[model samples]
Target chain A: MISTASAVIGSRVSVGHRMLALTWLISPLLLLATWALVAASGHYSAQLLIPPADVWHTFKDLLHSGELLEGAAFSLRRLASGFVLGASGGLLFGAALALSKTVEVYCAPMFHVLRQVPSIALIPMFILVFGVEETFKVLLVTKAVFFPVALATSEGIKAIPRSHFEVARLYRLPRYSLLLDVVFPAAAPPILTGLRVGLTRAWMVLVAAELLAADSGLGQMIEMGRQMMRIDVVMVGVITIGLIGFVLDSSLRLLERRLFRWKAIKE
Target chain B: MNASLDQRWLASTSHSPGALQIRELSKHYLLDGQPMEVLKGIDLRVKPGEFVSIVGASGCGKSSLLRLIAGLESDYSGDMQLDGKAITTTSLERGIVFQDHRLFPWKTVAQNIAIALKRSPLTRQEKALRVAEHIRLVNLQGFENAYPHQLSGGMAQRAAIARALITQPKLLLLDEPFGALDALTRISMQRELQRIWVQHRSTMIMVTHDVEEALYLGDRVIVMDARPGRIKYEIDVDLPHPRERHAPRLQELKEILLTELAGSDADK
Candidate 1:
């Protein structure tokens, strides 16, 4: 009886341990096979629905010609610049709002209204204002990134328990250390969630901005491909943008897991 | 070990004033435009190196009294002193361990303990040593890297106790520190606390509802009554440290405290 119970527990543990890796590949592999089969069945024209082989070839050609690599690098550079500017500003502004009632009362309503305006919807307005240049793209992406991070940061700071603040006061923790040690660490999990949301949204906004107007970048590549009726190239750009965004999000999640190991294993 | 009880505590070494003093302390909360009194005209004194446990029925403001002493509540009208200084706000010299282990869930037990020492002037090595010592003092030596959620109820409370003690506070205020623990764990923790009190001999005031616990640990037990809470009775244990679980004197005190709490409940 004891051995049967032990066997049950051991099998459950083994299955649970391997679940993540197994789940990761299962759906994507299934989708790839289904796509390959549907394309082979010739239900749609190749132009309208390229086969997996055609997409793969276009991907290889772009990589070999270094177009894909350089295009992605430029897009990444824009993302990095805009995200840094927006996220940092958002962090500071959010903390200020949390700490000062005047800032909250003054800026909160305006910020709320502004955030409701989609960054994509502002593309034409931004183009007219900034002349379809890199400034327009960066500023649009910044708008996309800023609000979520700021709102999350303020909410995170506010959510910290009164007990922790009392402990901080008892220890005579100074302003700088109080922020660095108590406030930051306590607020970090929620802040990281905010950062993750901001990052994905910014990536989407960058692609959208490039779609509207840009000399280069993955979204521009797709836009140019669409205008010229090079559907395979458009497909390549779409897949690359998606893959990069997925990778960035997954990496942030990895960092969150490492930083909050104590919270992770509990769930 | 027996003689150490009579020896002066190194922390409050010679000529130290009272551990704590409260003079006519009262608190009123504005509830729905009505002034609700919590603590009323309470005067108490705790000598240096003494242990006191407070027991009362629910709503007796026992926890509020501890919070007042720990400087968590400052809006009260009273004179509260620690080491002969006025208590206006929280100070490291006065530490508190709550009923729930308030260790940051993201930090390990060691990190949680070390956080309390961040403002201290101790060196990195000294800080690590003090954390390790306190972890060991709470009998949590092997679980330094364990998170609070990973620990059992008893262990988490012990870690909380360790964090409170790491500062070497002049007075430690505990509000039902073991109230959440299961029966077996509570007994073990009481023994552990007794051992630690014998070793450190710092002034500790614990608020509890357990009759046995108040009798076992306190040098003096203060029983409180509700409806604008004030002390109804005080019992001196007059026993040495590392007290036995089944001491006759403690059992007698337990009956007296149980009667007091029951009597107050009956009145309500």
Candidate 2:
């Protein structure tokens, strides 16, 4: 009986591991297969319905020519710089609003109203102000990253129980120690989630800004491919954009797990 | 060995250090824009190394009184003094344990206890040693690295107790510290707490709703009445430490206290 139980448990563990590994590949494989079958049916126009092989060939061509890498690097640099500026500002502003009643009362209404104005909606005004240049694209990305981060940070801070602060007071912990030991850890999970959402939003806005008006970038590359009627090139650009976004999101999730390992153990 | 080290350290410092004196202490709160009295004319004296247990029904202001004593609440009327000093704000000399344990969920047991020592003048090594000792004092040595969520309710409350006592507070205030535990765990914890009290001899005040608990561990059990809460009567157990749970005296006192508590309910 013991042997059978051990055998069952061992097999179950291996099955669980297999399922986890399969999850990462399942969706992409299914999508690829569906695309290939649709292209092979010849029911649609070939110009619009490029096969998986053609898209793969185009991806390789772009990689060998270094256009994809250059566009990706430029887009990433803009994303990094803009995300850093917007997220830092959002964190500080959100914490200030949470901590100071006066700041919250005075600025919260305005912040809420302004955050409702979507980043894409402000593109025309931003283009007019900063011109069709790096500034316009970076600013658009920053605006995209800012609101979600700020809202998340403020909400996270507010959600911390008053008991935590009371405990801090009981110990008479210094300001820095209270913040470091109590406030930050208590507020971190939500803030990290906000950062993740901000990062993805920033990437989407940056791509849209580039597609609308830019001399270079992955979005511009796709736009150029569309103008030139090279559907395969556009497909490659789309796939690359998706892959990069996935990588960025996954890296942030890894960081969240590392920092909040305690949360995982609880579950 | 570590226990003796802790005992020696505690002995070297002033023993039986805290003496709490309350003079007609009353507190009011704004309830829907109208002032509501919670505690009314509460006067009590606790000598150094005394264990006082307060029992009352819910909304009896027993918790508010404990909060006031811990200096977590400062808007109350009347005077409260600890060691001849006025109680205004929280001091390291007074530590509190709430019923819910209130351990920082993200921190391990060791980290939670060590964080309480942040404001202490002790060196880092001494703080670490003291944390280990207190963890041992609570009989939670192997669970040092466990998070609060990983602990059972009784274990988490034990960790909370260690955190409260880590600063060597002269006065330790517990507000329903064992109210959330199961009957079996609660009994065990009461015994554990009694053992610790006998060993350390700190001035401790615990507010509980359990008459048996108050009678079991307290040197003096004070019964309170609610609705503008005030002390109704006090019972001196006149018993020594490590008293038997099934003692005839305790059974007799429990019956008396239960009757008094029932009378208060009837009056309410």
RMSD of every candidate to native, in Å, equals 4.0, 2.4
List where candidate 1 sits over 4 angstroms from the true fold: A1-46, B1-17
Query: Which digits, one per residue and each the tens of the lDDT, describe model 1 over residues B153-218?
Result: 899999888888887788888899989999999998889888877777788899998878988899
The per-model lDDT (C-alpha) reads: 0.86, 0.91
Q: What is the C-alpha lDDT profile of model 2 across A24-119, one tens digit per residue?
A: 899989999999999999998899999999999999999999999999999999999899988988888888888789999999999999999989
- On lDDT, the leading prediction is 2
List-wise, what DockQ does each model earn? Answer: 0.62, 0.73
- Expressed as tens digits, the lDDT of each residue in B1-268 for candidate 2 is 5898767666533335599999999999999999999999999999999999999999999999999999989898899999899999999999899999999999999999888888888898888878887887899989999988889999999999999988889999989999999999999999999988888899999999898899999999999999899999999998898999999999999999999999999996
Model 2 residue B128 CA deviation (Å) reads 0.9
TM-score of each: 0.90, 0.94
